[model samples]
Target: MRFYLQACLLTTLLGLYLCISEDSTNQDEKLPTIGVSVLIRNKAHSLPYFFTYLVNLSYPKDRMYIWIHSDFNEDNSIEIIEAWAEEYKSQYNGMYITTNNSSGPLHSGEQHYVKWIPEHFNHVIKLRQQALDFARKQWADYLFMVDADVFLTNPDTLELLLGKKLTVVAPMLLSDGLYSNFWCGMTENYYYLRTDEYKPIREREKTGCFAVPMVHTAVLINLKRTVTDKLTYTHTNLQSYDGPVDDIIIFALSAKWNGVELYVCNDYVYGYVQVPMEENDGIQSDVEQLVNVKLEAISKGTPLFWDPFFSKFVDYPPPSKYGLDEIYMINLARRTTRRELMEQSFKELAMDVKLVEGVDGRTLDFTNLGALGVTLMPNYEDPYHKRPMKTGEIGCFLSHYYIWQEVVEKGYQRVLVLEDDIHFTPYFRIKILLLLSELEDLDWELVYIGRKIMTDDEEMVSRYTSRPGYTYWTLGYILNQSGAQKLINAKPLEKMLPVDEFLPIMFNEHPNDTWKSYFPNRDLKALSAAPLLVHPTHYTGQEGYVSDTEDSIVLDGSAFVDGRIVIDHATSRIIGRINSEL
Candidate 1:
């Protein structure tokens, strides 16, 4: 009986130990290895932004194996890639670089970077095959192929693709127009056919993982769901090769033949693909001119989107280097949090600031315009918004008005006006310095450091800046003495309007034909920095962000449709999405 009891006790102990061991194994499991393959041809202009996003991917750097091929080069694109690879070479598990493409290199300026030549196309396919084979040999669990022009804002792009568990997938990339990375249907001629679902999915009106005919630019191939050996990007796997000689199309055909499903996920805004522009400067505008990475999360105004999550505000010198008289931030008394955030940002950057106390419209008596030297049309509704201005809007306008009044009263040469919720770009100080240098000789009253491009006519004034045609957002700007005097002389206090809308009217750029008649002497020479130096700290749906004029709702970002601009509601993109995933 004693021996039997001992045996039973030992068995129970052994069972508990096994359970604990299994739990430990599960907890310490290694993440899957990812193989990143890239094909570049004279896209060095966009490399800096691409590298910025690539280095910060959420996945472990050691877990990612990189293979870069610049088959046909014309400029220093190969050199740029080599430079980045040299810096980050050790961080990755493995690195492969090849500039040998039998297709031959193009001269300084030959075919457009995006060419359809058979030889070039064939070489692309061959290189893709080589990359895939290389990934397979490395025992990679997944393969990521990103073109040089693709900019991934979301660091978890790889993880997100993996979660879908699809054979092949890509995050839909947006452009200035309706261009994206996926095609809904392929025609008989094997060209892209726009279907009804294409626009809706691309616009995120219908958000989900959608099965599509083609996916490229930035796509992930899940080896777990696919047969590694059966895949080919060339015509070998295709039943018929009547399609265009483009490698992406051929790969799509091969994918279809190999029983692989291609999908594009639009559930979230990941990043964007740089569409081919008419002028081929062979350098990325963002790198050459400090252009903002064009995106579409907050407003549907311009391709240039504000990415505060990765904005990575660096502790650089202040705009004082840009020759501004004084830096002032307008903050509402109730918004202590915004003030704190802005204060911290400025403090970290080590900049002096003068806080402009915001006036509460709720307490103001607009009954007498003479006393305030401001005229507000009685019961005046916004012409475009088609609604009476909110009390908050009144407060916002007055806050800005009081600042301009200060600018004129003090006779400041150049004063930077910033809203309390302003978010700085990573290279704000340097970019501003570079931009102001270009504008020093130009004639201008108001120089906008940041704004929303409401129209398409953003004509380039200098290499680094543009003439903003009907822009919005008074979030950041440098008001000169002339600008301040013009605002006061325009009798803006008599006809009250949102500061943003009023600025456009004052600049003679408002698209609305009706508002021009209301304010006739409207020609305040204004210019905007191309990439925009600042944006709101919180995007439309972000938790702490508040817009008095645009959106009064404290939550639900989708409701923030500023003048028919439809956009997705972001729930703190990185953290919120991860929580939901968990």
Candidate 2:
């Protein structure tokens, strides 16, 4: 009995020791090894950028294995791939290059050929299968199949996709228009079906991952699960529409039949750039230009979308260098869509912005107006004849009021306010900073970086000026603490007017006697940057973009033209004008 008890104790201690050792092993488990299979055919021009993208991925290069399959009889793709392999093969776990020595060029379908045919599409599947076989032999944990033309701009793509832990996942790669990686749905005949979720999936709020039937261009497949389940990319023998199917549809259908789920992550901007087809005119030049622009933007720490605009201003520094750390920046966005767009824009400009959830006047309680000591004026008339202030206007006014209250409470020296639809020029921040520095001693109450110079006469006072007439926009402006106090104390809520109109009243005297008068000591010393630094995105409709603000209102024939006419200081001539239809 004593020996048995001692044996039982020893067994229990061994069990506990093994459990602790297993737990520690799990904690320090190695990252999964990824095998990247790329198909290159006549893509020498895009190879440089493609390799750069691969090298910059935020994944362990030592654990990645690359396999390049080139089948083009013409072009320098083979040479480039060979050079890349020689240089980078040592960094990765393994690197392999295979070039088809076929006497004739591989049959790529015509420029406009639809990919529904089996023969034309099977070639790509064969090459992919060959690479997959290689990866399987190497015991890769994951297999990432990527087309040579897909340019990944986001460094965290691999890391993010790995976190999803899905059987198969792909990042949505977008090109010129609606073309992307995933199909929304399929028709009864197995053709691609366009569903309503198509566009919204591309533009929707950063909600979550989306489940889809098919994904291509850049797909990450969990080989560990797939191999265990006996999945193969070469399953083109599957029937779709009563005929042999393409590899993408075949794989998707196979996964579905096997109860495997596929997902596409749209939570963040993946910054994917798909190279245009060769049939497009000047394809080489366009691809080169895009590559240069993207590389430059990355180097400058700016978003890729800003490359085109930034290219226009070669002499000026990138927006990332201009810091607004001293100024409190507030952006008013009502809907999630607006907020997302505004935040993305700010990020591109490297601006640190705080979002103020805009007040929706439609849902506002009228009884609450009494708390602000304000009342809606009865039979109020708008001079522009555009329309009277709606709940939207009330909401806008309240938003400003709330911001002013916070400013007073926090005692911030100055705060920059921006509407959601505002767009900044290349040197907007620099110009605004310069204007502020120039007027530091002027005791200015308000500075308009971009505004409708509603004043009849132009007043120029050392890059700062106050006009006789009232200005009309609140799109982008800076309000000092004094201005905030004056605005809060004015209490225009007694007979509430549009925020723009009420602002002038606060600056001047209350046009009516019912409101509290907090007119400043010096007529609210104000200044406007000449040739405005910023303008509404929908100003001229040159870009054919709609304005959410104007669209919300019911307008008559009145065309509400606003914003300053930008000018070249040296030339003293109009450079750009901001015009809008009411």
Task: Encode model 2's per-residue lDDT on 438-556: one tens digit a residue.
Answer: 76677677777767766566667664444424667677778878888877676556556677777666556234433224333325666667767766655545444544334443211
Candidate 2 ranges beyond 4 A from true positions: 2-27, 101-119, 226-228, 236-244, 275-582
**Residue pairs in collision within model 2:** 374-493, 374-494, 375-493, 375-494, 531-566
**Candidate lDDT values, in order:** 0.71, 0.64
The backbone clash count of each candidate, in order, is 10, 5
> Per-residue lDDT of 1-582 in model 1, one digit per residue for the tens?
999999999999999999999999888668889999998876655666677778868989999988998856655667677777887899999998887545456633446555445656677788888888888878899999888767777778888888888888999987645778999988999898879989999878899998889888888987755464666776766565677767788778777877888999998888777555444544433342323233222222222222233234212335242477788888878777667666655643456789898876544443433466554444345666656555567678888888888888888988888887666775465677787677778888998987877787578888777888887778899878998998878877666667788899898888776766677889899988888888765677866656755653211122222211111325422110111213
**TM-score for all predictions?**
0.60, 0.51
**The best candidate in terms of lDDT:** 1
